[model samples]
Target: MSGSPPRRGSALAADRAEPRAVRTRERVVRALFDALAAAPLEELTVARLCRDAGVHRVTFYGHWPDIRTLAADVFAEEVDRLARVPEDVISEAAGPAELAAAYERALRDQLREILERRDVYRTLFASGSDAGFRRRLLAAQQERAEAAVTQLARAGAEVPGRASAYPAAFIAGGVVAAFEAWAVGGATGVEAAARAITAQLPGWWPR
Candidate 1:
């Protein structure tokens, strides 16, 4: 049986509301980035953010519980893009040399970003107040690691007998630890750190 058609007024109102909500979120994100340029994440308050966003406190709370959650939501996408492995790097058709070069380029890109944002990285790692953002960073890296491992296995790489999640988590955790150490200690340059981190990957990993 066919369902009754929807009310035109209600459908139009719903469509309008969605765009308005998107605009509100975009404004908030812009305000947050502007605030961060002048001050650290921990220093911004809901009242100030709402004021800068030109949004009511109730509207802000409706979108995010707090500023930390908003920051995590915003920065997580950047982390995902930085950490994601290229498809060719895990494709079976790619030779070892090609895979190795592509993988190294991707790793170096992530490391360079870390170097560029070392101050923000250090703040996220060191401050308890920024734990949500740190967790978001770890989660994003873990997702990419899992994708790479899964794709590599499908491409004939020998994965461990245990669940794939275990190895992926280990790899992601190690990368996060390496970043934290580098940000906090400034022990090695980006190239050295990238090489060191890549060296620790499992033998079965592509390159």
Candidate 2:
């Protein structure tokens, strides 16, 4: 006869396991980020990552099927750090000017964080890197842009029908390009890049 399947665990055991799992994952993620910062992604391998993470090969595999999947998660987490803005900042804005001001302030804060992780941005956005990573980054930015446009419209800003989405797409692409340029040393500084991106928005707005 075949071996019996594993038995179910108690609720208390599962509760304890959850925090341990989280801690292990966090250690692995931090190690991955450190490794990426030290070398190009193309040079990275599962064995090296597991060693650097101080995690067993099985543990790493338990959390991620492969290095690429782990990489995508790292990229997404970094992108999210730059994309999230507090809702309360714009929630109370009374007009387009106020909303724009709130948006600019929020963007500046995000840009500061981006600059702090300049090395990661430069490596990830560099030419000849994985195309899939670029697509994921772009998709994340576009999602945020769409949400921002929707919020502006809900806040009484005049978003012209059918054409409203155009602004979001344009802004998202331009912002990403500008940041990439800045990260690669093509642009002067973070503040200048942020300003340049914000300046183009009014042109894209329905007028």
Candidate 3:
């Protein structure tokens, strides 16, 4: 954990690039979700989704076992949307300061994303499409948590093997709560919550 991150472009590329398989997968997920907005998730059918995506039934079944699994996955992907910019926004970060600053920016971005995609979240959250709302939301939050871990780990913090996942989970829960308390009221405290959580990490911050 010393020199610059290994193949920054190559690594970052992996984050952005959607292989054909991934694109098809995401398209199917999105199609299913869009259909859910029109009706509840339970109403979605493989035949309808394939038609929406202009794909074939055989292809759909090749990728998904059943519509429920596909529905669960669609929700998972939707909730798990993440951005990878805050860490790069700041330059020579060190210790908690750097992490906190990036946290603030990222939190702000998250709110912006939520607000901008309000229609999407509202439809998804309101549709009560699937029984896996909480689970999918948790999964979504975990993606962000894991991204932060990668950033911090690259920054220099030695993540304790035993308690690694705990920090992210604790922090992500805090994030959602803050959004509920302040963001729900049309106020913005995302940055504040992010800073607070990042400060709680048990090691020096990374740049």
Candidate 4:
């Protein structure tokens, strides 16, 4: 007889390995973030990152092929965290005022996260940095913004224009610019930045 099919949970556990491996991966990524904040990505080496993370070079290799891969993973994780905020903020049942309040809350969450990681974000997105990395990060944000627009549309909200995507892309670009300014200390504060982003959304949703 053929071998039995792998159990679902067992398959997942195998993919993730044990808790120790997960912790090590987290440490490696965190170390990369810390290291990148202090210097450019070109300056980082696997040996240095391994030393900083207190993990073996073999372990680092097991998790990622190179620093760029690790950087992509870190960006993906950051984007996923930001995406979760909108789920709590937008609801199908929310009225116009309620939706506005929720948008404010979500905007605050996004700005607060940027402030918390200001150094790292500035390092990654600063002009003359890694073009690929900046493009990936911005693309992720655009995807998130597009997803948010889809959610609003599904909730029976009236988005501007026959092409909802145009507004979404515009909003995403504005958000990126706002965060860049805030990251560089051009914006007055997190609240002000949040207000600016929140203002842009009002026209997209029925008020």
**Considering summed lDDT, which 10 consecutive residues are worst modelled in model 1?**
7-16
Candidate 4 achieves a global lDDT of 0.66
- TM-score of each model, paired residue for residue: 0.75, 0.71, 0.51, 0.67
TM-score of 1: 0.75
Best by TM-score: 1
For model 3, where is the 10-residue window of minimal lDDT? 7-16
- Tens-digit lDDT string for candidate 2 (1-207): 669653221111123258877787778788877886788666778799888878887776666666665676566557656677677766777765677666676667667755776666666676334434566667778888787777777776776652556767777788777667666775446677777777777543432
Clashing pairs in 4: none
* lDDT (Cα, tens digit) per residue for candidate 3, span 1-207: 778653321113233344765776777777875786687555677899999988887766656666765654554454355434443453466654576566566556666655544444444444353534445666567667776666667666676662568867765676655444433345345556556555654564443
TM-score of 3: 0.51
Quick one: RMSD of model 4? 6.8
TM-score ranking, best first = 1, 2, 4, 3
lDDT of each: 0.71, 0.67, 0.58, 0.66
For candidate 3, what is the total of clashing residue pairs? 3
lDDT tens digits, residues 28-126, model 4?
A: 878987897788676789899999999987777666666765675576457446645445556544664565456556667777776877765666566
| Model 1 C-alpha lDDT per residue in residues 21-57, reported as the tens digit of each score | 7798789889988998888777999899999999998
